[model samples]
Target: MNKNFIIKKNREGKKEDVPKKIFFKTNLFYKEKGFLKFFIYSPIVKEYAFYTLFPNGLNLFIYDKNTYNKYTYLRADWVKSIDKMFFHIKGNIIIMSHKGVSLKTEEIFWDRRKKKIFNKKYTKIIFHSKKMILYAINGIEASEDLKKIRLKNINGTFPVK
Candidate 1:
């Protein structure tokens, strides 16, 4: 079986196509015992990054390792639905970083962890869901307004990977 896989996500209530560049650019790095690692290229950033996927019991984790950052997700109670060409992890996803912070989201795609740099310093934003009221962020000082969902913009440098 081919090691490559395709992940599709819903955006703005519509199915968005996964960029074709992702298929050609993601090179298999390693595979062992139901685990695989690949280097996925992001056209948005015009760079290559690492992705690792491994399954443990009922949970599957996909780790994204960038030049200067590491992010991971823990998907629990995922009921698999296999089609002719693709499989899906149907459940909630917990997005985590090397820094140990995490946010949980339902039906999210590719753990939306982003890093920004300015003046030699960097910040991170772990955006999981548009409806922030449905999920929670654990770690850092987050705001609490039942009427307003809180997201954190943390100031910290990503550890060298």
Candidate 2:
């Protein structure tokens, strides 16, 4: 519902709209929907192994540090295992991988927050909020269509600047 949170934080300057302070393992991320819908998904810890379902319906805590190629689908078995281990969270906030697509959007959301599977989406010029993680679904039922942040070696953009 707001854009202030999306402003890149200036390391040298004071950061606004962001949490007062984030610990080494603290989960931090922002979420937003079509236009006015907004929320922040803050994980309990810095475990990137946690799984996220789209549309804010599911939450999984995985610690395997496992990943697949871009645009790959999230199998039901994988989703089930993630659910079974929804508490083995670990790591430094593992983020979703686009699988391989290089596109910028403004419509990211963490859908189905009540389920064990997470769905997400991307858009352009949506709102902004402080969240530790986001789960969303943009009218899609498969994770393969979700263009997440991919790994560098997988022909995706590097997280480093």
Q: How many Å off is the CA of 19 in candidate 1?
A: 28
lDDT of residue 125 for candidate 1: 41
lDDT of 2 by residue, 136-155 (tens): 22422323233333222122
Q: Per-candidate TM vs. native?
A: 0.26, 0.20
Q: Tens-digit lDDT track for model 1 on 74-138?
A: 44434222221122323444435444455444332221222210111121244333311222233
lDDT of model 2, residue 129: 25
Candidate topping TM-score: 1
What lDDT, from 0 to 1, does candidate 1 have? 0.31
- Model 1 lDDT at residue 138: 32
How big is the positional error of residue 143 in model 1, measured in Å on the Cα after superposition?
Answer: 23
- Span of ten consecutive residues with least summed lDDT in model 1: 114-123
Residue clash pairs of candidate 1: none
